[model samples]
Target: MDLIKTEKSIEDTNKTNNQIESIFTSFMENTLFKDKFVLQASYTPETISHREEQIAQIASILAPVLRGERTSNLFVYGKTGTGKTLSVQRVRNELLKRDINSNNLIIEYINCKLKQVSDTEYRIFAELIKKLGGNVPATGLPTGQVYNKFLELIDNEKKLIVIIFDEIDHAVNKITDNFLYNLTRLNTELSKSQISIVGISNNLTFLDEIDPRVRSSLGEEEVVFPPYNALQLQDILNERASRAFMPDVLEEGVISKCSAYAAREHGDARRALDLLRIAGEVAERNGLKKVTLKDIDFANEKIEKDKILEIVTTEPRQFQLVLLSIIDIVEKNERLKDNLSSSIFTGEVYNNYQRLCEKTKNDPLTQRRVSDILSEFDMMGMINSSVISKGRQGRTRQIKLVIPKALVPKVKKILIDAIHLS
Candidate 1:
């Protein structure tokens, strides 16, 4: 009798599994996405909108490589999400399409922010060597040997090579400008091949900080990418929306609102695209047939909250403690009903932070160090710090939380748990 009961249970479980599979398949068939990747930030469209002038300029600079002549090293500068990386990549794609049969050309792209690949001078050289079909271990080799192998590999090929360093500033900050100096100075030593570099950065002032010789060699020509205005952002969103969504899936005014919000925050095209994508996901999750303005608002809030959580979770413990101190002040102000604002002066925050450090059995950082951390938080958009002065009282920074009130409880909980764990 026990065996028979077990057999019946197995039959029921199989039936339930089949039903679950059928439900998932039905949902996939009904999703609003036609080609969802078109709305992704990494997807490069066949035709780029509103960047024709920039593309034409870059193409002209790189055009010399096709005729067996060396191209000038190029520097591209723009704010984040202003299309600097995409335009360069697009130009390179076009060049490769035209040079398909010309094995005499090679193009390599590296993002310096990538972990264990371009983070240091040795790792960057190791990556370049491996890309050229040469063998080099990720570690266990001296820097000089890695450089020699890279040079030898490049010298063997009688081809014109173009190497693009995206976010070159990160590498410079980590390992200094020596790597760039070496690459720029290498052209004279090569006998059989020619090389060019295209450096892309979001920081406009980075060039001024590098060695003058390195700067002159690396920046033969420079191009600046301007941010897209609201109308231009709208046009871009419309183009991608047509390809990404089913007919009439997006309600009226949805794209316009997303574009406007992003434009107000420095005209970031990536932000606009993210808003649209997340809105669609939210609508689909709610089983809605169309994405509406309400969905966009919800997505915006969710994205901001998630960004705050990410910043808080990844920050150093000291930074987290500083944030908690700010939170404690805000809570105290609320309870007192003193009619005074929640914003606290830096000195008071430092005192509270010290007390919290003692409670957690951690040595407190110096006041100057805490002030520096506060400045960093201000730069990161997590908090606002402004300098204020009273007559003969000198000057101090006034700090306030920038995140929404609703998020304070969540942040406080995380900080408490982290403090206990430590």
Candidate 2:
């Protein structure tokens, strides 16, 4: 009986291998992409459509670099996928191309969202030093020494150094606004070279959180990029699709549906491109010649799941605790077959949240603050909240988790691990 079972298992393994080979063979034969990179978010096209005004504005602001003069520190504000970074990059490229002297201008870009790069003031200075052809120990050195090394590297040359801090708010949040104040004050210390800052953030009100001195220096010139409209997104999709896919690979209405989906997401062109690319991938995996509406649907669901997971993972400690409290209520109600599962009250969530905070040894935020987080959750589509009048008892919000029942367990696990809940 053992030998017979071994032979049966070998046969099953061979069958599975053959099935995998078939799928690979199909993928190789009917690949739908002609130039997949065109659909990627990182692709910088020869011409950026629908952002001419923003580009011109950035170019004008930074044009002083051509005369070997220090340009005003520029603050760029925009929502995600609104072409802020791209426009700034376009201007940077154009400036480099037009400037006759390269040594007089040095431009460095640091993405503050990147790990191991902008977590603290030391890392930020270390990154800048390395970018300027200087090296320092990754750790164990005093931050002042690293700052001196950076200043020395830039000051040795008679050039204007422009450091672009993308997602600058993240760095400020991690390492206070004192760093910004020091950077701005460095101009008074430097004898040869002047330094300018280009701060970029997705938050419109990021400046409001900064110290007034830092804000005045860092936001000398401000540019805001508005979200693209549905038509603008459609234009972008049509242009990218022409190059990203093979002839007749995308079925009719797929582009429109993808554009509409991204439009509802505040006109996120990156999301639209991702939707189209993922839809094509889904079609190819299914051995289809052309992407269909069903493929778009599948892609949307996949992106939604990924977006929610990312949001939950990166949220603040309080957010995770609040979300966990909701998850617990929902799970307990489901297990007990209770009818109140759909109408979890705010007071109940607050009570559970307090318990979670106590267990984690965290000082809980005020009830008003927790209520604000729930409102934010509602805005983010993680929950549905409705205000119910209790007549003489006052008013309370009726809360329900909208995070697809299937995803609840994974979100719960992330919250549990993040908060170290046993």
Candidate 3:
């Protein structure tokens, strides 16, 4: 008993000595961005904290009184990361706060960003319904049936249901538009749950592609949230600092610098917050007491590296090959035009690809896949393609790299380095 007591005392003392909560607390308090809306935990946040006007605008449009007339719908369009998702989420919360009856007011947020094909809409529809405790099946159901089931749940919610289709552009391809049309039109025939759709998209041209009938249904209201300016971003950072940080661990310049960078990227508050948090991490990794200007710079580089690689990884294999080939072509030619005919460009890509793999001693991918990738690259905005006749061969689509003719050298260098290093 005496030996055990001594051991326990020693162990407790050692554990106490090893613990560094007080020191770590300083780091934790300084950089944690706790804005629920901005962090987008449930949805996106009102990080800028002044979208109250927009939030109220969205809420007023879908006000509960509109339930009987099939919900009046809405569409929000803007560039990427302009707080569309976050704004819609803020409105959802506000709507729910106003004496929402679980059976009546049903708010569902579906991120179509991850769903691509037409059929996937059915899945998203089912998931949204399931989240609301609707009787949604596990799959194998017909699209019509699943859609009907989704409507049935909406009907049951019967008061005011606000559905947010976030990143709607990603899934706006030909096959998946059925769900969009139906959701807007569901109440035209029946009066169960009035649903007002709040579609959030980055593409300004998304509305042009929707069928006239769908557009008519979806044109209930439109509100565009502008990106934050640097001054606005700095204010946002200050607001967050009080709640998220502990002491003077965060420097004043941190907010300004992050704001400047984020402002340059269209004044995205989320980006600013991300930079600040990442800067703190860089500091922590380097065993620094607090994040500083140097750490922020390092974080910026890291963000750029990760962003570029992520952009590349998401590209189709053919596009990746095309990009890789362009890097090699620029290296060899020393001078390439901003736009070359697709026929000539494809030749360059194919030839350079062969040479690059040989020099790097890497196995070359087949040309068929390369062709497919190039097509996708064009589609995904990596390069441009157009049909041009090749004499007796008839019209064939030509391809060209859209990158600045001068910047091609740097882009090529980075891409090649990424390939061999990774």
Tens-digit lDDT string for candidate 3 (117-147): 2227667767776777776666788877877
Clashing pairs in 1: none
The lDDT, on a scale of 0 to 1, for candidate 1 is 0.90
- What tens digits encode model 1's per-residue C-alpha lDDT throughout 1-422? 55655777898979889978876775686688888899888798888789999999999999999887899999999888788899999999989889988778899999999876789999888888888888887689999988888888888869899999999999899987778998897888899999999999989999999999999988889999999999999999999999999999999999999999899878899999999999998988777889999999999999999999999988989999999998898788889984476677899899999999999988999999999999999999989989998558778998888889999999999989987798
Q: How far is each candidate from the true structure, as Cα RMSD in Å?
A: 3.5, 3.9, 8.1
Comparison by lDDT, 1 against 3, better one: 1
- Which stretches in model 3 have alpha-carbon errors above 4 Å? 1-48, 65-71, 100-103, 116-119, 156-159, 174-176, 314-316, 327-346, 354-422
Write the residue-wise lDDT of candidate 2 on 72-181 in tens digits.
99999999999888888888878878875576888888999998777799999998888888899889999989988888888887988888899998888899778999
Q: Score residue 328 of candidate 3 by CA lDDT.
A: 56
Which has the greatest TM-score? 1
TM-score of each: 0.92, 0.85, 0.71
Clashes of 2: 0
Error of 2 at 331 (Å): 5.3
Q: Where does model 2 exceed 4 Å of error?
A: 1-5, 99-102, 310-325, 331-341, 347-380, 386-397, 409-422
A best-first ranking of the candidates according to their TM-score comes to 1, 2, 3
